[model samples]
Target chain A: SAVISQKPSRDICQRGTSLTIQCQVDSQVTMMFWYRQQPGQSLTLIATANQGSEATYESGFVIDKFPISRPNLTFSTLTVSNMSPEDSSIYLCSVVSFGEAFFGQGTRLTVV
Target chain B: AQTVTQSQPEMSVQEAETVTLSCTYDTSESDYYLFWYKQPPSRQMILVIRQEAYKQQNATENRFSVNFQKAAKSFSLKISDSQLGDAAMYFCAYGGSGSARQLTFGSGTQLTVLP
Candidate 1:
């Protein structure tokens, strides 16, 4: 299992503003995933970040709205651009390796 | 594509009692894995138990055990002698065996242990 550190743990941003969440893994992993959980809702996959390549976004999510960057195997960033009130949710980053997946503490974003 | 389902949205158990959480998954891949994760209010996900598909024997960890029904695509978690520390959200997850390790998680069941 790998430990993941995510920051800013939480933030309150204006509707027009943007926020970038960073996730760093203790060890190298082949796949990293970003997920969003709306209040009292299930987790939804945003995208899959592969090191040194463009991230693969899930259906209903676009690269422009949630751009992802994986500079290396141990680091990835997810940027929520042109945010809106609907973007208010908890964003979690998870790393997958050796048949196991470990998640970060998660970033709680509130867009007002 | 795989989908995990947790029928109960919330459950309550008295301290020192046992409770079971039901989970069912729909997947075409035979070589997959099931997992149970606990998320406290702190929002950090912790692995509680996991069951490998190939193994016929169920997995047990100290006070937690899983009844895996491969044929029925069902996996249920049983927590024995529940404690206040077990009050949290439990999520059932499924993943494939190969390079794709992305886990499909069910809608979590919020467990509250009454003391």
Candidate 2:
């Protein structure tokens, strides 16, 4: 099992500003996933970050809005840029190791 | 593309009783994995159980169990001796093998444990 820690557990951001959420794992992992959960909605995959390459984003999400950086095997960062009220949601980081997936506590962002 | 569906939006069960949460998925691949995750008010997603499509026997963990029907592409979770802590939002997920292991999540089912 892997333990993950996400920074800025909860944040309130102003519109047009950007907030970067950091995810650090206790051990090295190959694939890291980013997800977004709107209020009263299911989670949607934002992107998949692997070390030494660009992240693969899902449909309806663009890097211009959510840029990801995976500098190493154990760490990654996701930046929510040009935030809006609609961007107010919970962001989660997940890692797959040994065939099992684990998730971080998640960051709750409220854009005003 | 694979999709998961959870028909139940909300359900209530008395303490020490049993409750079942329904989940079904659509996938073209023959081999895949299904999972049931629990999210409490803390917002942490905890994996409650998992079942591989090839496995004929159902998977069980403590008080939680699954009824995985491969032909029907259905995986339902049954919780016995329900406790107050069991109250939370339950999500069903489906994922493929190796390079195709991206998870597709269901809408979710909000469970209330009545005292």
Candidate 3:
């Protein structure tokens, strides 16, 4: 298992502002994923980020709205741009290690 | 594309009893993995169990076990002698073989363990 440190744990942002969530893995991992869990909903894949490359966003998600950066194997950041009430959700960072996926504590974002 | 489905939105079971959470997924890939993750109120995602699609035998970890049917594309989690700690949101996930094949999650089932 990999230890992931997700910053802020939570945040309260205005509708027009943006917030960046950082994910730091204890070990190097090639593929890291970002997910959005809306209130009372299942986790939806926002994007798949591979180190040293651009992220692949899901169908309903876009890079402009949810920008991802994978600077290295162990670090990645997801930015929620132009936040709205609908963008308020728990943002999670996940990594696949030893054929199993491990997640961060998650960032609970509240947009008002 | 892969989709995981969890029909039950919520379920309850008495303490020390047995409860089974149902999960079904659809995918075209032959090589993949299925997982059951428990998310407590703290929102820390915990991996409960995993079943490799190639393996016919079910996967078990202590009281948590999975009934995996490859042909039916069904995977279910059964918790025996359930405890209060087991109460949380359970999510079924699917992961295919390739790097481009991303992991998919089900809508989740909220399990309530009554003491």
Candidate 4:
């Protein structure tokens, strides 16, 4: 089992500003996943952060828009750069432990 | 790419009754996993149950069970003896076999347990 802690459970940000969400896992993992859940929508994969290498983003997401940093095996951060109202959503980090996927308490970001 | 589809947008069940949420997926991978997750008002996603494609027998966890029809690509979750605490948004997800097993989620179904 994995216990994940996410900071700033919810935050209101001004448009054009950036907010970085942090995720700390209980144990070290080889790869971590980042997801975005827009209002009234299902979760979508933003990127996969692998320690010692760059993060791999999904088709609609790009590095510039959502830069991720995996400084170590147990920690990762996702930054939503130049936020917009459309970017207001819940951000969740996930990892696989014992073949089960565990998620952090999502960070709800509201961009004004 | 794998896609999960939950046809039911909303469902209600009387307390102590049963409810089933529908889910269908499209994936070419023969080896994969199916999951049902419950997200409450707190936005914490809790894994309700899981089923493996290789398992022919259905997967059950206390009041939660799945009717997994691999050939039909359908996996439905049945919640028995529903309680008020069961009210939440239920999401069906598909995770193919891999290291990370990146998940593809369905739209979601809001389950309301009526007293």
- Tell me the docking grade of candidate 1: medium
Instruction: Please give, for residues B1-115, the per-residue lDDT of candidate 2 as tens digits.
Output: 9999999999999999999999999999998788999999999999999888888999999999999999999999999999999999999998887663558999999999999
Between 2 and 3, whose DockQ is larger?
3
Chain A TM-score, prediction 1: 0.97
How does model 4 do on interface RMSD, in angstroms? 1.3
lDDT string, candidate 3, B5-94, tens digits? 999999999999999999999988899999999999899899999998999999999999999999998999999999999999999999
- Predicted complexes: DockQ each: 0.74, 0.59, 0.60, 0.69
Q: Residue A12: error of model 1 in Å? A: 0.8
Highest-DockQ candidate: 1
Chain A TM-score values for every predicted structure, listed in order: 0.97, 0.98, 0.98, 0.98
Clash list (residue pairs), candidate 2: none
**Model 1 chain B worst lDDT window (10 residues):** B95-104
lDDT by residue for model 3 over A1-99, one digit each (tens)?
899999979999999999999999999888999999998898988999999889998899999999999999999999999999999899999998766
Error of 3 at A79 (Å): 0.9
Fnat for candidate 1 (0 to 1): 0.63
Instruction: Place model 4 in a CAPRI quality band.
Output: medium
Per-residue lDDT tens digits for candidate 4, residues B31-100, read: 9989999999899999999998999999999999999999999999999999999999999999877676
The C-alpha lDDT values of all candidates are 0.94, 0.93, 0.92, 0.94
When candidate 1 is compared with the true two-chain complex, its DockQ is 0.74
- Model 3, TM vs. native: 0.96
